[model samples]
Target: MASTASESKRVVIVTGAAEGIGRGIALRLANDGYNLGLFDLPKAEPNLTAVANEIRTTCGVRVSTVYGDVSQEEDVKRLVDIVVQELGSLYAMIANAGICINRPLHETTAEQSDKLLDINVKGTFYSFKHASIQLIKQGKGGRLVAASSIAGKRGFAEHAMYCASKFAVRGIVQCAALDYGEHGITVNAYAPGACETSLLTGVDEYFSERKGQPKGSYMEVFSAGSALKRIAQPRDVANLVSFFVSDDAAFVTGQTWLVDGGSVFD
Candidate 1:
């Protein structure tokens, strides 16, 4: 059993907490003294458990792990309920669970696009809705953060539907920010460029094959395109999320920040 929440420490829910950027954010927030409610799909049980245990032992912060698909409204609602029940109060929600598919627009099918939108767009919507409801009930100001890629800001080749879904996420964030501002809930998104994650690995593989280049050649090209002349690490993105959820950004909302090493200048 986990310890009860300390009033001094805030509690947050991070979806897709098993791996990649989600895992990075979880570890960073735990170290920052935030109790965590980590959510991910059932297939990610092993990685999720490991992250939970690591945080418990190292950060000594209370953590509650829940397995569910974010695309389901019931699952998201239950996730919020359980997290509050176990961790005490919900201070913020990080809707980082999303999927990507790399394929040309012409070759993309309805099924592929639907699945991508279901998880990336619909999943984000559900997370925002439930988290907002919980925060309003508590009558405490909170943060709502979601994953929006640089693709959400600009179109990329072979990322048709994926871009569409992320674009929708930005719209949702902006709208939610307006709707929830009066309730003291801030909404925003973090848009990462070519990050070193499994999602980028898939993008790397797709371009490598399409271009007939070596395995890592496309990744090198992606790295060079950024102003930093390198790719972003998971921790890099996590840092932005930390600031967004902190008191430092209480007045900042309805904006999608690009943490892409200056890849897409907005």
Candidate 2:
């Protein structure tokens, strides 16, 4: 498929597009008629390339893949620049690259907390900052989205580090929305619950070991806690992201909306 111009399809940069929810969002946005800038860590180069290939073959959208650590400011700036050079102007950015630490407060070291905050909090800030700068320069409105978790809304037993990072993401989202609203850019986040991703699997494994239960015990517990009695899929969260980057959400900003299968009520 030929590459579409920025005015025709709109271009979006989705960080951590190698797998899981980020992969789902990249595919969903491509299908939504947006050219995609797929970014992920170098360690995930294979999966990231596969995602780009799949999009080109299936969605036929102009998709470009770049590997970088979002925690680094220079890498993020370069990512924004490269995507624009390859796929035309940037219309939106999905800052979905994040990590989790499942340790009690007593065991959580300052080093672990620093790493988590650097990627989760600082990374989102860079994504928002660079994307909004380009959008403002273009003099056209755009979208900025981030990954928050149900952990951000309420505290969990052994998720002090994770919760602090996610809660900080909410603060960044609200403040960015206010700062960039005048430029016609919307900033929002999607807070998902126990989704069927590797991240959640890790959490479940941690809990299972701590409680001396079977492998899937924590997964089952989380599923049962939700009103739907099932864990969420990547596509479910992608659907919410689909709405946020679309014209329908132009009036909506500064929201950390929940998509947790009714697990955590605001």
Candidate 3:
């Protein structure tokens, strides 16, 4: 069993907590009073230590950091073990570590496709696996939130591999929800569209190159395509995640909530 500073406090583990939507979710959960176990790649930028310190000081919650690639099985196990050993119990798991490779279906190599699937699909599965075991051992209800994408719901021209990986993640979330619900665990996913983050910067370049347009023009056109006529911020997606793991969302499970500002309504 993990050590616990306070047994009554809720504990959460967030993968990819170094930046973008993952970072936003971590901050929001900290503000909501959840003691955090943050996991990220070893050389992740944006300084996770700074974020952890901010949360600890501002939220007055215990914060732990684990450095590892979410796609690696050993790393995933280590992350969960650290959280369970240190926090004493695991209440929620957010599998938000993902990577994207933008290329036409024919242009994507087998290696590239496999890498995307490994990181986005298998990485998420490992997170769920370890977190579920820890939660069951703790003998308490738990929450599992995976990060799917709007691409998972609808395919884009150059996002074939990314879409496939996200679709698999959504499928996993649904299946896990059904299986774990019997154990009082709620599993769900969030699908965000065109979020304004560094991750989308590459997409802007890809579209600009394909269309022979300037980078700025490509993003403007893309934003206008959305019904909201704007790109989403990381915080917007984070807010939805915060709600899903909260007590208010206890009854919601096995669903994919879109945080796309009406980009894809089904």
Candidate 4:
């Protein structure tokens, strides 16, 4: 679809739109009548492109794809540049790309830690920076939403790096909110507990193996952590993001809202 074709609609960029939470958020925005710039890794292009097409067909919204890594500044810059140039104005950016590898603090390798931080922490920082720049340029209010985690609000054993990265996300959201509020920009984060996504498969397996239980037992362990006794769905996270980017949340900024079925008290 032509970028200008959707110019009349508010455009939002969703990184990691190929699957999981990113996909849910993208579709939700499209359903809400916003144009989209969907992005994911080059390896995920086929899936990302397919998702873009589906959103365009089902939601009847303009959808474009930007295949690149979020951890790199240059890639993020190019991604944002393409969004503004192609999709027109960028009113919101959802930095939802993330990965989690379950490893104990002592067993966590330097390489693994670096990779997680580069993608989870630096990638989020890049999204907030570039999105804020575009919003400031537009001279209109905008939303900067990110994915934090229960690990962000509180530390967990064997999740040092992940906790640290998510904590940084919350910190960035608060700082960016304060720094950009004068310009009518709001920054916030959605911190979900255990969600039903491929991202949690490794963690679930690790716990099950440790307990000598079957595959599904780990999911139960996570559910028990929540007061509601259930894991969150991707759509739950997407719904919280929808609120963050909506006009209803204009007064809300610099806050990290937890969507973990009462798992983490926030």
Candidate 5:
């Protein structure tokens, strides 16, 4: 339902559309006149649909959903297919589905390691692979954006496996950008620091427990490390992604942008 000023609406597929930075990116793209295919875990259908409806009513753009786990390659492949089928074109693919476990490296378990790699690293790989294939096939260069973290820029104490996975995301973006540049597709990432989300709550709790401090005490420590002396909002990250997903960024690729408000310089 893009306005008549444009004859066609560009489409974007956003994974992890249920909450956090994913929801912020989806909403931001909708407001920017993109028809959307909102992807998330099956359990997130209700929340995802609510988000989709809000976009449709408020932005007057077409919005659809695909519920599946991002860890499975087949699931992610089908996700892009559904997006193309439902939305009519795939203009941008934002692989924003990621998870982190906050625990010391020595205490990390194999199960936790596998889960982290599967969802954070492999999930991004699957998304980047399938979306790039579709874009190449379409013969129209497109944007592929993945979620990284400040931890991706450098290692974190209690977030060891999480850091490794995000580092993998950055590597994949760079490699994919190199491989796909000839076809006109660009690959990039958005790395955010602590934000006001459940993910931050998890971080705060982990540090709080290790420091023997109250629940929110450690979050203040995190905020104070940032040059801005404030935590970023999800929208802060989403705004940068909006640029990467736009024609304005067509010439920019193979870059991992820090949305961390000077928390980490790379």
Candidate 6:
């Protein structure tokens, strides 16, 4: 079948594409016939190239992987350079790299807070900055989809720093959307709820140690607060991101779509 204009062969960059939600988004975009440029740390889990190869073989789109820390400006610039050189042009950028460290506000050290802000907030800023500049240079506009969190919409206990970072992401996306609208660029964010990923592994360990329970035993406890009473999968969040990056979502910008299974209704 012939692909639509939005689904046509276009260059797309996905940060944190080594695993979890970022990996899912990369695969989905590939299935829609997007050439892929995946960025993540060199030590990222799940072997980014393997996932990229799988997409290439299965979806029949070119895939490239660049190892870099999104928090570093030089690294992000290198990533964009690779995408432009290898993929020809940039059409979409998904800023999905993030870290979560849940702890009481008092227990959260200054360094930990700084690292969280660096990766979650500053990293996203760098992604948007480089990708938007490249898209503007291309003179075709582009899509910018960022990963916020349900924590951004509403604060969670013992997650003060994480919540603050995600809230900052939403604010940034909104402002960028308004600023870039005249240029035909759209910026939006997804607020995903609890998901089963390595990011949560530390939280699980923390809870198990604190509550005297098995690591996975608290999955239900954490999910019960949501109206759906089920934790979301990474693909669930990825699917929403896929939609937002498509032409169908051109009319939708500066909006925060919550995919937490009704965890944050507002």
lDDT of each: 0.93, 0.92, 0.87, 0.89, 0.89, 0.87
- Report the lDDT tens digits of candidate 1 across residue range 185-261: 99999999988899889888889989999888877987889899999999999999999998888899999999989
Candidate 2, 1-266: lDDT as tens digits = 11333238899899999999999998888888789999999999999999999999987689888889999999999999999999879889999999998899999999999999999999999999999889999999899999999999999999999999999999999999999999899999999999888988898999999999999998899899999999999999999999998888889999999999999889
Candidate 4 lDDT (Cα, whole model)? 0.89
Least accurate 10 contiguous residues by lDDT in model 2? 1-10
Clashes by residue pair, model 4 = none
Residue 203 alpha-carbon offset, candidate 4, angstroms: 1.4
Per-model TM values vs. the true structure: 0.97, 0.97, 0.94, 0.95, 0.96, 0.95
Off by over 4 Å in 2: 1-7
Q: What does the lDDT read for residue 136 in candidate 2? A: 97
Winner on TM-score (2 vs 5): 2
Q: How close is candidate 1 to the true structure, as a TM-score?
A: 0.97
- Two-way lDDT contest, 1 vs 4, winner: 1
Output the lDDT of residue 40, model 1.
98
Candidate 4's residue-wise lDDT over 1-266, tens digit each? 22232446888999999999999999888888889999999999888988899898998888879988889999998989998999777999999999997788999999999999999999999998898888999998889999999999998988899999999999998899999999999999999999998888778888789878898787887799889999999999999998888888889999999999988786
Count of clashes, each model: 0, 0, 2, 0, 0, 0
Q: Give me the overall lDDT of model 2.
A: 0.92
Error of 2 at 101 (Å): 0.6
Candidate 6 clashing pairs?
A: none
Model 6 RMSD to the real structure? 1.7
